[model samples]
Target: MTEQVVTGGGRRGASSAVERVVATVREGVKTGRYVPGQRLVEADLMRELGVGRNALREALSRLRSDGFVQIEAHRGASIRRLTREDVAQLYELREVLEGLAARLAAQRIGETDHRQRLVAALESMHEVARTAELPAYMDENIRFHRTIVELSAHPRLEELVDQLQIQTFRIQFRSAAANHDRTGMREYSVTEHQSLAEAILDGDGTRAEDLMRRHLRHTRSGIMQLPDGDFA
Candidate 1:
């Protein structure tokens, strides 16, 4: 019994370590610290994350299943890069999913404190945009969308959107950062966000859904304009 207890505790500890490594790497990818196609050296990860070899490998495996990492037999692990078709298909799904989320959120905006949360999220985006910090703006942009999905009050919908958003994080960050020099583009995004927020707050479900879909379509168009070298 003593030996079994020790083994169980050890397993839990390793699992915790792996989770930490996974979260760190995911955040790095989302924030553009790790670019697509950049190799993830096992030794470096092990050192930086302060985990054992086994824990790091386990974390890499988890990230691979999450579509964030690609592991080649000989070349080892690198951040996954999406193809043009992949980007298109992802946006197509996002348009449907997020549009529905916005509609539902609008209908349910008065429930609980969702309205306040969403308003705060939108204000954060505006604050970040005013500073012209692309990274901060992108972070708040993600938070704003997440707020909408949370306001939808649908567990399964939130789960699906979260998965899709995770897969698209690096792509979104790269695309936005690449166009940071274009002030008009950033201003346009802020305007669209404000419009979407108003529709949701007003409980106009149809308008909210329409605006969300159009917003996603515009984002997709911008990503499509990126050079081919950015895609697989």
Candidate 2:
């Protein structure tokens, strides 16, 4: 018995359905609610989401395009399994995207609103870090990076960054969930992220980009170094 909340219909509801389904599935993937290479049967998903086959498949199709799920000829849609190569490729692309975002953010970051958002986000991360809340730290980790990308003030950049983040997240989430040394990682990441916020606030895009690229590089290397199934 899957409990799904479905309300509204027609034009307005259509867009909302897609977002709701995507968020639900993304959360499941991030938290290991669905395992790596988990086969998603349409019928089972329909029941689980309390949505029709069409809506469920639409969501799956979007995720497929996003690289979160792969649609193979015979295997259908399954969660993507990240190889070392995939991890390398994901971080490589992320470094470029984040670097560009930071560059753009430096010139465009005059708005107090964006600054406030970043400050608030960093404070939330500090609170979680003090409590040693790994889950909270991880969630804030995502928010912090995304907030920097959002500062680019370019819709297209924002769009591309969102997709790239999703692709990178699949690998990171899987590895971190299983890594035994991840608690220490949380602390390290918290400090690095706080520095990133300060850099952005200083309006030094170059430094921000440098910090982001360095962070991505270090993270990718560390995750790759971890023993298989040792990423908790």
TM-score of 2: 0.80
Worst 10 residues of 2 by lDDT: 1-10
lDDT of each structure? 0.89, 0.76
Global fold similarity of model 1 (TM-score): 0.89
Backbone clash pairs for candidate 2 read 178-231, 178-232, 179-230, 179-231, 179-232, 180-232
Identify the candidate with maximal lDDT: 1
Candidate 1 clashes: the total is 0
- TM per candidate comes to 0.89, 0.80
